[model samples]
Target: MEKKMTSGKLELVAAKKFAPYGEMYKVVDFLNKTLKDKQVIFGLTKDEKGQMTLSIYET
Candidate 1:
């Protein structure tokens, strides 16, 4: 069985071909400053309302 994720925790997912979720260019720039990878990392997380949200970061 799969384990349940803790509240407020982030889970990483592959985002090789997809652009960042919001403001593609700006998100890339923000990530580039902290990470030096060509591929972007997508994160799955739950919001306060228990809705799933996707977040992006540079690997």
Candidate 2:
């Protein structure tokens, strides 16, 4: 996900093949706090099929 500098919201785009299973809101809330306050990026790779991505920047 990328943090839009103007709106200060996360933006994610992917194909329909990418479907993540879990409580996304909880995860996003956690990430917002961490990335916004700490300025730290996080990412995870799941083989070559998909990945979880985040940015560490504030507007």
Candidate 3:
């Protein structure tokens, strides 16, 4: 699943990936700073083990 958020002149995208903890943390941090706005979207997914993951994209 994916969640999207947008504001005037700003947009955010979030996605989830099945990756290592280090990679996931890097992605989350990047998105947090990259977006730097309340108008952010979050995308979530689950692995076969039922582990949920999140990713974010911003513009």
**Top candidate when judged by lDDT against the true structure:** 3
- Candidate 2 lDDT: 0.43
Q: Flag the better candidate by lDDT, 2 or 3.
A: 3
**Residue-level lDDT tens digits of model 1 in 1-59:** 12333334433333233322445555545665656565555445444654544455433
Q: What is candidate 3's lDDT per residue for 1-59, written digit by digit as tens?
A: 56666666545455555654545556666766666776564545567875667755554
User: lDDT at 26 for candidate 1?
Assistant: 59
RMSD of 3: 5.7
lDDT of each: 0.45, 0.43, 0.59
| TM-scores of the candidates in the order shown | 0.31, 0.32, 0.38
How big is the positional error of residue 31 in model 1, measured in Å on the Cα after superposition?
A: 17
TM-score of 2: 0.32
Best by TM-score: 3
lDDT of 1: 0.45
